[model samples]
Target: MVPSSHFNHIRDNTDLKLELKIPELNSQFARNSHNIPPYAQNKPPKPPNLALKISMAAKTTEAPSLSFPRDIFAALSPSPFLLAHLSPQTPSTPSIRPNGRAPSEFRKPTIHRGSLTHCSGSAVVRLGDTAVVCGVRGEILLAADIPNPPSAPPQPAATDASDADADDEDDSAELSQLSLLVPNIELATGSTPTHLPGSPPSTLAQSLTARLRALLLSTRLIRARDLRILHRAPPPPDAAATPDVPPTEEAKAYWTLYIDTLFISLDGNAFDAAWAAVVVALRDTRLPRAWWDDDVEAILCSDVPAEARALRLRGLPVAASFAVFAPGGGVGDSAFRDGQEERAWVLSDPDAFEEALCPEVVTVTVDCTGGERRVRRIEKSGGSTVGRELMKGVVQRAEERWKDWLEVFGVGNS
Candidate 1:
């Protein structure tokens, strides 16, 4: 006779009720277990808490995997190329813009100033879906202690005030105002599926930084004179030496700026977004009041907010970018024969998708200072050859954009 002790006990009422329906199977299982060795029955029941802890540990130890949306997957994955041969037979729409906008039309811009209280100045700018934040900080330093000082040419003869001003301008080149102009662009997570999180800046980012630095200096957008900080110090005691010359004031201190920018969302037109952020942030920047202590020979900054002075920007240079898309073969190819309708389109301020598909791109920067506008920089790249007239048109559009932005910032009329 099989011992009932060999039967696996169904402690839960639900399990017991289910087992009651299969009495024969249950009995057989019990008889088979009785025949087995005693060692098999010695196993311990797994604790509910321990089992849960194991599952939780497994989940905790597992590394997170990268995730991308379906649309981005479609673009980056092999599916699109594999399905390319399945093109529709009928002609598609004539409008080339992905969003059905005119070729020269630009997305609306939104700007907010003083977004950061800790920074000397801060601004957030959004163009379409792209967004960026810029912050400016000022620091005081001595003239002799400035970093990377441009080698001074033989001090030109101080013939007049213009010559003195020129010398000051030369030594105090725009970048010299600060020891360094550091710019970094990070592709923030979740902003887009294309930019992977925790990745370093791309070649595109480096190119943008170099271009911005060049524009800031070449365009003289920030006046160097505004960055100068002066601290008055008493002249050294020399027993009234050189009594023939009149006593003049002595400068004991200097100052500079640190500008930082961050890209929160990127959907093409990042250059434009970053540039606008910088312009607005610089406009909002202020330098704290500081003076040199003769006893300590150190610069002392005033903590009182009332003593801060605003930095005056020399000019505002706005950048506008265009993506060139050509149908029926690449631009300037034989596909244009037989007087075929020109299918080329220059989309202004293209989003990520449009920018990726488009082969050629053109960027035009214009200076809109004191109500006068002029082209300051033009960057054209890619295989498509664009004519001078097209570039001129791009510049004209950029000027219009500058005017619109100035009005939005209350710098000029709409």
Candidate 2:
């Protein structure tokens, strides 16, 4: 069973105080303590140079050429992603709260491993509101199929073009086939406060999938060569000369491993949660060996074990999201951390509800590799802003958020 998740924040008032006030935390780092720097000699004779302070204030009093959003969906607008999902009060569409933050941070996460006890390895992973499960089974890959024996190969030279065309058509038909029978998502009947029946993949889901796929593929987490298995179509019992063994049905036949993901909970950024869950489960996966001995020959199914290989990945992709605050609420300096009031959720994480209330938003994907990290892409959303400086803070905060996630995951600084 996976960890059932609920979205929450460091909501306790004391936590908020600690988060908001640190540098001035005279108690946490008292000067009199032995931990103090050696420069402090117990002597007290230093006084501020009032003349120098005045000169600096006079030189730099202009309210920093503030940079903020200019349009509804531009660098100054609120989070476009937030406006896409619905709230508990309104299931039909998403709504923003005045104070921001839905009082929850992340939905519950559920992880089930080895769902198919009969199969070599399998897993069903659900991440708080966003769910996904994947299974791995053993199978002997059969050699490439051979074309039916030709009766009489002599086609006229005049029909050469027709033969070429026939081959092209067959290849094209095979290429267009879509057989991804695995349901990529599953929802806990209770993800949302209400049920959204008959709803196809929502725009948010589709967008998230694209981003997730991009991240997974770009990183090369699982190589195609590694996943390949020798697939064999056993001869059927109907044939007297060759033993005939009927192939299994879609659900039963053919080793089909599934990763069922349900979005019982809907937050602004379900993609990140889903990706994290998948990564964790994959790291924990192991395939058992399958050996078969017939009347004549012995067959061995290849098993992908951690001891034999390391999961090859291009790199880890991290997403950083931001929210815009209205004029009445609080806005922080994303660029400079020296401001006392800037501690408002700008340079840190924000829950789903907090995101909706903000007007302008930005999301960034970062890749950590080669002893360094770099920005892969920057998605700028539209929304109007109260001032120009707010936009600047958004960009700065986006970078900081990326750094924070890296540190949290112990992936190292970008």
Candidate 3:
């Protein structure tokens, strides 16, 4: 604490000249304060005018902004996109679907019969983007080859009403019990993305086949008499002695029709298109006149085209498919609405986009050929939004669709 040499060393290290220069520095600052710019005084240098620079840059780079295409928008958000089209913002804009069709409007159907030359009968039916081709091929099914043949009915008396009734009953179940009518459906790989090449038969194809077979049997569209090949037994050697005994005719074989369907393009409403193709193809089928040849112990068919006979279809039944689109949200959130809850749209012949968004579906098959609407089948699935009133509306649409098909087939209303 009393080291004079240490104190002298510290004084030497410290700058006494710097202490004297502080006053001069303060005077220099005071002089320069008057010359300094007002923005630089008592404040950090201001940042470059960022807002002005940004405005100038924006002015140079200004251009029209591009928007997404309608197709892209629909693919991105299908439900909202469809709803926007269905429910317009202004009253002047008419509500319509994305495809520019009204909700109840069905796509026009185009049918071309006898498209395939090799098939016994063939037809190509197009309902909008959906297209189906159906072919019918007939083959002989010998009764002797059947594992369990049906019992032969007794010979009917000329005017016996009871025997006639028995014959009718037996004929009613012949096709179904014998498994004579076979239907098969194939979904082509390129027709839809879900059906890939080399894939086995899909559930959709199997279900369609089952439905077609059931309809064929239940509707009794093909009569058993047309398919039956009869052979008359020769009179016995002693028959000349008994003139009253007539030669007996027996069913030796039957014709089996294999109905095959293929989808060329499938947008939606696959079942309807498949069914229409089947009906058209069947109507165009002409089976050759066949008879049992007792000499050859085999069936023989006439080669002449004039000898071919067309099938007698009972009625022309058309199928109409519909989908219900119901948007989900709170009140006032959605553009579509009813009194309290959200509203639903019943779209007829929905396309693939609409099918993807819709959960409820209804398919009605109706026949209006008799001047009276007769419902053959009604298949509803997915949701309960379709009530009695809605079903009535669906039936009305189906009848209209039926008439449309008749017109395509060149048949006018009677």
Candidate 4:
């Protein structure tokens, strides 16, 4: 029998204890009794090894198949053809791009000047599938006959000085005249599927009109003074109408221009097409000669071809629009540690399909008059913010386009 001294150390240890008593075995179990021994009883087990447990736990997760560096793994994956297929379509890449033009190239326009003979001036401009027609009509209005004529304010009441200033403000507001350069835009059913016949002008039409008017006035594309019509005042009741009488000083009259723009078809770049049409139409406009009649005390106008004069325009404003496409937010997987931020591609003069893919758009207008280029306006829409370098590039491209347009119109920039 084994001696008890073998387990003497276990007695002093609190974590282990040995059973002092052994049970007598019956005859049937006596042979196997020696095989069993009373070991430490009711003893708490030792804590597991923390480091080994952690190592075993980590093996539970699945690891990536590619053992190569993230950068190399991403580079080897996704062939060029697959990448092109996966990426959004653009104008530059021939594989997915609908049009064959380069990223920065604009579609050539077909312009027809003076297409409407009965109108004072008219033009039709087509950029790609988009087309716009513009017409201008001029009419002379007497100072008193003009709507919202400017008049002197009445004397202020003697009671309060502040009230005088308030009265003057009110008078100024009342005397404001309607703008002479009136622009109206209409998008008919032929332009698009959404534009219905007999429906009120769509919000887009109103917005275009307002935008064009603002740009015209703010950029000084047409000088207001050039539209003035001057005629001598009628002679007094006693004054005689003699050939020797000196010409009386002329009273100033204003010309009211009705600029109407209509969209025939729209694929994209509606603003650019409409603005170009307006520019060409105004260039074709002519005004009739007007003279005062002392006998009748009225203004007379003649429709004789020789008596007409072309309306002088100040500058040419050319607009270029761009559609920007960028990848949405995403983080690189373990296979691609050097992840890219949002990537953007700027496309000039995109067609309808390309424009539909991009939510952000930028429109830049440049005045290329007097042989100098100046940015007249920059309009942006959507959530993205265009970088300054991109804006500069857009302006530069617009200047080049302006030159091309000038050549088409046979107009000099002097």
Q: Pick by lDDT: which candidate is best?
A: 3
Worst 10 residues of 2 by lDDT: 172-181
Kindly list the per-residue Cα lDDT of model 3 for residues 1-414, writing each as its tens digit. 688998888897677777888999999999888888888677786676989889989998999788999889887777778888888889898779988899999998999999999888999999888999999999999999999988876333324564345335546577888888999999887999888899889998999899888877766677776677877777789998998975666788998999999999999888888989999999999999998887898999999999999986677888889999887632222444435356788999999888888878898988887599899888888877889998999999999888888889896665
Winner on lDDT between 1 and 3 is: 3
lDDT per residue for candidate 2 within 1-414, as digits (tens), equals: 544342224346667788779857766667657776656656775766999889888889867675544344333434332332222346664343333434223233455655655534445544333445444333443222213311222222224575344422322111112111122544445565444666676666566656655555444454332332322334466667644533321111112223334464655456555665455445444534433334434445455654333333335565656555433342332333343233223322344545555545566666655545566666556554424575455545445554544554454442
Model 2 ranges with Cα > 4 A deviation: 1-183, 197-203, 230-258, 288-310, 326-349, 358-361, 384-414
- Which candidate model has the greater lDDT, 2 or 4? 4
Q: Which ranking of candidates, highest lDDT first? A: 3, 4, 1, 2
Q: Per-model C-alpha lDDT, please?
A: 0.69, 0.45, 0.84, 0.71
Best by TM-score: 3
What's the TM for model 1?
Answer: 0.67
At residue 394, candidate 3 shows an lDDT of 95
Which residue pairs does candidate 4 place in steric collision? Answer: none
* Weakest ten-residue segment in model 4 by summed lDDT: 167-176
Q: State in Å the error of residue 356, model 1.
A: 0.7
Candidate 4 regions with alpha-carbon error over 4 angstroms: 1-96, 147-176, 233-252, 329-341
**How do these models rank on TM-score, best leading?**
3, 1, 4, 2
